[model samples]
Target chain A: MMSELDDDLVARAQHGDAAALEQLLGAVRVVAVRYCRARLGRTVGAFTTADDLAQEICLAVFHGLARVRGPLITYMYGIASHKVTDALRTAGRTAVLHSLDELEGRADISPGPEDAAVAAELSAQLARLLATLPPQHREIIVLRIMVGLPAEQVGAALNLSAANVRLIQHRALAQLRPVANEILSEVNP
Target chain B: MTAHHDQHTEPAEVQHDEHLAHKLATGQPGLPQDPLSILLAACRDDIRAAENPAMPLLANAAHVAVRGHRRRTLLAIAAATLVSGGAAAVVLARDAQPGSPLWPITELVYTEHADLALIRMALGDARAAITQGRYTDAQIHLDEAARLLTRITPGTPAQQLAAEIGTLRQELAAHLAAPAQQSEPASQTPGARAATPASAGGTTGAPTDPGSPGQRPATPTPGGQPPVPPGRDRPQPGEQQRTTTRGSSRPPR
Candidate 1:
């Protein structure tokens, strides 16, 4: 699902166009941040900074541009996923995420906060729900929802057919139904 | 979506899934897309402004990539030399510029750059100085690089390195000679914009044997007129031995 522009950027980056590398990473920074934030979930504020994690991923991607054999997103996601998973392994040792029973009360939604925070609260709730699913399903939902990549692109990155991407996304959303129904309904437009 | 439990479905179910899929891609409905935008903005700004200690990292990385390529090239060439009994492909990758195969790998290889690390250090110094409007310092460091470039044999494997230095010298010379080009890079350095005008004002209006602008910038202009006493600036009305600094102020102290 690599776009022609991304392919061009990647080619230029590999050829050591420093500005192109800078631009390529700048273009993808948002997605990388989203992925890292989702994977970090509740651990973001406590265990690691999402910005730092995303920057680390960018540095890795920048340095490793030559090793990319597939779409740029896949290579980026691969590095971010590894970094997040490694951090999670360490996180699981000392900290515990709220159990399913505690999920409702754990969300500290401030009444006077801006709508984006409310949106983020809902998104955080969704991320918690996403965490409950298996890794494969979780990845599809994040890339599809958080990163806003097309299923075709997601499918190409993940090596699944577009239909399979849709199917997995459907299943993943189904799993989030319990949390989504309770939290998202109350969010403002 | 209906929890039919079977992933395989009828066209009706497929239609439902498609509708749900559209919503799903937007993130659990009303979740305010891009939950991390604010958090990500800070990091993006950090990179864009080059405000971190790792700002030089990309330049180092370019060097690293070129080094890796050099290792591979040398190994390949060595293998080829052995296989062909000291015969090889044309030894000159002169056509390989920075984006080309020869330039990046062969031209910039550490061994090819005379004095290896010293030349790199000097070039980095020159680059930073150039970006800061310190063309004099840039010329000095570039001069060091050129001196090193000459130590490299003309027809040897490092000839390309010498050529690269020659190009850098020409560029540095241009930056040194042009007052206008010098002003542009000042904005790149911290506190340089403020310093640029002072420097430009100093050089431009220092009385070129006639009444000119900015002989004294930090002083006031009454009625927008210059504050110079008329005859005082023009050599005391007939005193001999008047000399202005070469392209500068303060009379060559």
Candidate 2:
């Protein structure tokens, strides 16, 4: 639904409609926020918030709007891909220090009473499993399953055909299943 | 998604995994209690529970950016309009006459070069008035032309216009000094009609004499004034000589 609205808004914005561009920025910001949240779910000491990363992506999209030739969502996701990757690299550099800091901060950092601690662990495990895949396959799965974009949009974002996207996704899920089954047995038993 | 499902199923386990992946990707309902479905569902549930404290701030930032962008765009358009509109006004007002509606614009944009146009316009009015036998009205226009000639740029065309103004002023003076009082000045006696010399002398005193404000009082108050009255309260011609380049519409070379 948002992808459809994005296409129409992209057309209007490219034709110099500022209101359409604003609306498009807003819609894209929401999706970017979701993608950043899902991808960065388990970073230990998030020096940068997912919303900040999403805001950065929206700003990049706004600045690069005139140069966009393909779908606006695809262009926006392309920016998202780079920003998230840069953020992850930064987080990786600080991971050991953050982990040491987490030891002291564990009591304050406990999952809240109303929240499911197992869900947080499971989300971390899922992120770890996803991190094991190749970058392109990981991106496809994230955009397809986690971000809930249609396969066609994922294909467009990654510059692949939809059929290729499905093939990659199928192979990716097959690879994830064994490890997923192992995690599932550990969690359930 | 279904099309990809039917086309790529090789085995039962693969088909089952593909179905689960499809359900998760498309957010379909009624999933089986498979290992992958539970794992993915737990991940989705955790992500859904993740705090988004920055959503409102992000939204506000987007609004601010949009408003700023809109303001910048409007300012750009306004600047372009001012530039292009000014150029268009100069172009349209190039041929405007002294008393025509666009005359002020012409005078403003083509300040140094505009005296020639002003002289031409006054000459045109004087010629038109003389043909209609309004001698006092013609004298007023010729006087305006003579006043313009005092500070007009010195060039061949200006010299030509000055000579034409000279001849027209002389002819108008002769016509006003005639004894007939034939045209519209019903109250003027012969002695009052003899103020054509004063009108002609006003132009000479305008360029050389600084303290003579009362010299042209009788010249402007005559009964047979032109339909479009002269600017009696205008500044002195010496003070009005803003001799810039006048680049807009200078005659050839």
Candidate 3:
């Protein structure tokens, strides 16, 4: 797993190696971006919003690096989890505030003419499906599949045992399967 | 406790379902492409697509964050050094060498600039080995150089060293590509030919290192990147599920 290499980087960074610190932050950026995008999906300004959140997560890790004692990946993801929740909470508030302004912001969230393609529609559909899952399940699934974390690392990030991660993953996908199939049927029909 | 309760509630089904879930999540080859599987794959693709465009901006942000931290760290270290004074610092600096036990202290003090010459020497060895078609030797030197490069500050000098390493890597690739293509078809047949005898020899040579063979397949992946899908195959719990699914009697697609 990447965490094996990351452990080495963390060791180096802790010793005050600036290059290693930078490299460690780079890896954190990748994970943060993947997690944010995966969690946020194609909501209005999803790309920019995810990038901004990822930047915040990176800065958070940089400022907090000295305090981190555990696996850096787990620490970084914990920060990412918090940042994403904050963003989602803010987005929720904004959505309610703009509920009256239907025309302008609607285009941003909705699939435009360019997004009429199959892949975009499929991603949008899947994003909605993912949103319906419980938070822990959704987070586990995203970290496992989207962030491509191994079950052990996913367990570490989520504070579950590896066995628990696998079990939760199974149950979560089992829940998604019927809904996903129904959506496919509707699209085809 | 919750995990215990869940296990108690679904003792028999949990393991089997976990195995199946792992199979579907991993998109194991020859899977039936069920809708959930497709959606999972789509979800992965979505992040990957976003990753490329956003990488540069994210990298810049990381750079800015690190640079700011590095400055603050430098100021702190300078202040510490001023307080600690020069005599003991000189003694430690003089003591820290490649083989010395105090070598780690050099790392702690951020004195990795000392490794620059060693990196250059390693790079020279790598380049000569590359020229002589000693690819393995070149790889060894390159690995050493890269390891040393990590110690130094990542700026212009390090970037130049990396560029040189890249050039050597390209040269190494070019040398291997032709021979590799020629050997590919030939190796397969001979590999098949040797398979039985190799297995027989392996059994006879059981005293030979078992861990080496297991680790050999894992060495090619470079050190820094996140776990790719194939790399995800290495986790112990996932391995069993993978083997079981692959060996299952499900109809071939």
Candidate 4:
């Protein structure tokens, strides 16, 4: 669901305000980028980078802007989810996703060699752990962590009660502990 | 899926498990060097630096696209209108006598060599009649040209032709109202018919074609100069007869 601010921006954008359109798109860009990062796995190709996937989702959001109304973020998340799912299916059929250093022309990865290697291992481990969760639990973890959505808001977005969101999230994290230890133990030992 | 582990774990390890679960829920790490935080920061940096292609509002894009689509549709319609009209004009021009309304559409739509040739002949005859002071004959030609202008399809060219016809009509009307006014041409060309006043005219005196050099009709109106607005013409009484008339008649509709 949209925050009150996003809702207002969406309404203005629907009425043909160009500034509001840009603002609404900007608000969604980061969340959509994080969501794409979380869901796209460790594979990095031209279509696999968070930025590439986020651009795709934003284009889809703008294309469907006229047909939708209400909480802008939820509507956009739906688009992101659909695009991510489609990308996953396509990636499954296609074998290789090449790794890349630069995403958008000239952006440094910006971390030391040790920090980058550790981060990559953790990302691979987290991707596996997230994939193991039930779809609903996985969605909760992503929305809660990646989008930084509060439980009440996530509940509103997913049509689940706030209590249900907390319960599912607790169980998901409980399941995550042993797997995280396994990855850490492998690296340390 | 792992309920059997609950019975096997000791208290210290249970606390450790709780600590890890708590960290995951809060997006934290057990140690200061949390790789999750590192991953998040790197992704955020990359995303922030990457440029997004600009997009216009959907409604604006749709409006422009729809308008462009409409213009394409209209052009197709106009091209079809011209083609059908051209074919019709060919048949009619072959058989057209003096008083055909189809001549107007043909003259306006197809200004090809043949059509321009025919229209020029008619306009040239009208200009000749004006120089000869045949007001009635000139009025007939002006009336035909005016009527033809109305038949042209609504577009830019039609507007330009309409403006030209407007200037010609104003010049002809001014000539009819001010018979005493001397005109161009070296000879005293006797008028074929008397300049008759319209049944309802507002001019109380003869109107001069004010500022027109040598009192000539401003027909074949000068380029880069505005046509003489009828209101700008001064009503001058003849040099000898101080008598005036009122309520100058407007140019022929």
Candidate 5:
């Protein structure tokens, strides 16, 4: 169910209602972090931790909450989307390298053989395929498909028109089709 | 090689490819043996975990909001203090002068020079816009230049040069505010327009004897050089001269 907090909670939070504010933030954290991880995963070597980045998103939402007057989820998601995009821009290639380094550094952690092989193969393929799409296209696909934001909300969050969002989504899907087909074929073969 | 392949076989392949393309585009859930599913699932779990009520994410946001509010309050207080301090300084300076120190004149010159500089920048920006065929943007800069120049004060002599500078600025503003068809070529002379009134103010012409009270002094212009009458010796001693000129130009308010 969508979060039901209203403008009153937002106003109260602006006047320093910590509890109401926390409730508002809790409602949207799922979609927000998912959006961040997906967009960040496409980057190279991000140095900042995901939890830290998510915290930054939370801060931006709280700071900007007074100006946003809508359903808490929509407003929160909008703030989250902007924060995720900003984090991606700031982190650039570093995010991907950092994720890979983290994986490599965990020598004590043992994956089952099947899981390890699959993880390595999938990570390598994603790294290569993600490089093919433009940053904007990659962002929209991750937000809509992986993060599961509706088209209207994605458009609002990204500061794009809904029509533009759909158009970009279409282009992104078309571009991914051949890669998806090749991946399926390779796996089946 | 013995039996010819059916043409229908090629059509079937094309249809199958089309169907697969549609499925991929639609993101239909037919779980292919893709390994990324586990990773995707894991990421989904992380997202869910982040949403938990026990996490500190929400509490952190509350702290940040409080800090931001405090910072904004501090900035506003600082700005108010600065403005009040500046007004007090102006009052004390005025009281210390025996005769009317022409503050109005100085204000006029400072205002005029600033307005002129603004106009010049606007004109340059407009020229750039015109070249780019962005008439709307060019018009905006031109309008701002005009508004700045219209406020020029002309009569104050204690700040006479400043007023003159203001007049020149207004002139520049007027030029810029004209229709695109009438815009003048950029000024070729540096500080030329501001220098026009120096002779008329009696500061540049025949030096007044030091003994005379009403006579303009022949004191060597602040740069240790002979004074050129209006329209003549341009002060070229960089920022020092400009500062002295501004100081000498304040009008009796």
Candidate 6:
């Protein structure tokens, strides 16, 4: 029901209805912030906070709405993902390390026992393996897996062809396989 | 042990591959734990906050609308001014003497062309100066270039070229105006001046090579040596000097 209302509101916004523009943004704000926060959590305490970066993404989307020509939810997600990726690229190493330091300092945001063990182990292994892959391949994998974007939408946001997205996905998985197997064996044994 | 090993190897490979594909599809882990769920939920909240109807989006729309209206109004006024100015010029031209230049304004226009070309050449020289770290010379060339461009008549070919030259001039000016960075001394060549109108018109005794020595450099060279004067004699090895007296017979204006 909310989805239907969101679509209608977006349509009105597209046609220059400011009231509807506000309503559509209201519906999508949570999704936008969370997407940014999860991926950028490690850098939360940097010069540009995850929330600040998220706001930048929102401002970029608001101004860039005319470039979109699809369903509002889909377009919004695409814009959000692109902005987050751009922000990460622009933030550089100092910002990233600062964010990671913040994450380390935070005591209240710990993962659950089961997932914590898995995530900690996986994140450590993945970090090492990720250094081996090209930036483009790493980005596609992060967008598709961590960010939970559909391959088609990921391709659209990244300005990649769908076929290219699938190829990158295949290669990224193939690269991760050996590492994943090693980690699994160590864990299960 | 052999049977158990075989069972584990094949199924494990299949499961791992499938899990990867599933991860790609859902953009999340197959094992959904509480922390991951919390993070995903938070992301959803962030998206909602970003999209909040009462915030920055409305302000952005208003700003764009105002800018668009102002641009349209400016464009309309400029178009009307050009049309009216051209009509008045045509009416005034019809009342003038028969032998007068088709457009007396055209001579001014031609002069403008030469000036624009000179400005463009000067700007190129300024860019070279900036690259060589001669900030003072670059500033002087940039100012002259701007003044030359400003003198151009608005509807001529030179005017169009002036617009392009103006942008480059501004950039050069800004760099020159900035505080001097570390200065590296550059080797200077004698300046090259534009061809004089007399030589360009094929007048007798006009310098064949306007860039030759004996002609004064219009701008000071980097090493303080004046540029070679145009049309001074320095004959190439294989070229013959043929004096074919053509347009030189015309009476001087």
lDDT of 1 at B74: 40
Give stretches of model 5 more than 4 Å off: A1-20, A42-48, A67-129, B1-53, B56-253
Worst 10 residues of 3 chain B by lDDT: B244-253
lDDT of 1 by residue, B1-253 (tens): 2113344644565446556555544433432233232222222222223222222222222323333443353445334433442221213222222222122222323234414334555677667766775444554566566655555556754565566566666565454334433334433654554454644445444322122221222332344322232222323222221111100110111
List the per-model TM-score of the A chain.
Answer: 0.73, 0.82, 0.83, 0.80, 0.65, 0.58
Estimate, for each residue in A87-153, the C-alpha lDDT of model 1 and write its tens digit.
Answer: 6675567555433312343234223346435434544665566667887887887677655577777
Report how large a share of the reference interface contacts model 5 reproduces. Answer: 0.05
Q: Which stretches of candidate 3 lie over 4 Å from their true place?
A: A96-112, A115-120, B5-29, B53-55, B58-253
Best prediction by lDDT: 2
- Every candidate's DockQ is 0.10, 0.11, 0.17, 0.03, 0.04, 0.06
Residue B82 Cα positional deviation in candidate 1, in Å, after optimal superposition: 29
For model 2, residues B87-110, the per-residue Cα lDDT tens digits are 433354466544332333344455
Q: Pull out the clashing pairs in model 2.
A: none
lDDT-superior candidate, 1 or 2: 2
Model 2, position B132: C-alpha lDDT score: 70
Return the lDDT, model 6, position B86: 33
True-vs-predicted CA distance for residue A60, candidate 1, Å: 0.6
Residues B19-89, candidate 4, lDDT per residue (tens digit)? 54344434554433454333433343332333332221121122222334422432343344445422432
Docking quality category of candidate 3 according to DockQ thresholds? incorrect
Question: In model 6, which runs have C-alpha deviations exceeding 4 angstroms?
Answer: A1-10, A16-41, A44-48, A67-126, A185-189, B1-253
List the TM values for chain B, per candidate.
0.28, 0.35, 0.33, 0.28, 0.21, 0.25
Distance from true position, residue B215, model 5, in Å? 99
By lDDT, the candidates rank as: 2, 3, 4, 1, 6, 5
Best by TM-score: 3
Higher-lDDT candidate of 3 and 5 = 3
lDDT (CA) per prediction: 0.48, 0.58, 0.57, 0.48, 0.44, 0.45
Model 4 local distance difference test score: 0.48
- Alpha carbon lDDT of residue B112, candidate 6? 44
Which structure is stronger by TM-score: 4 or 5?
4
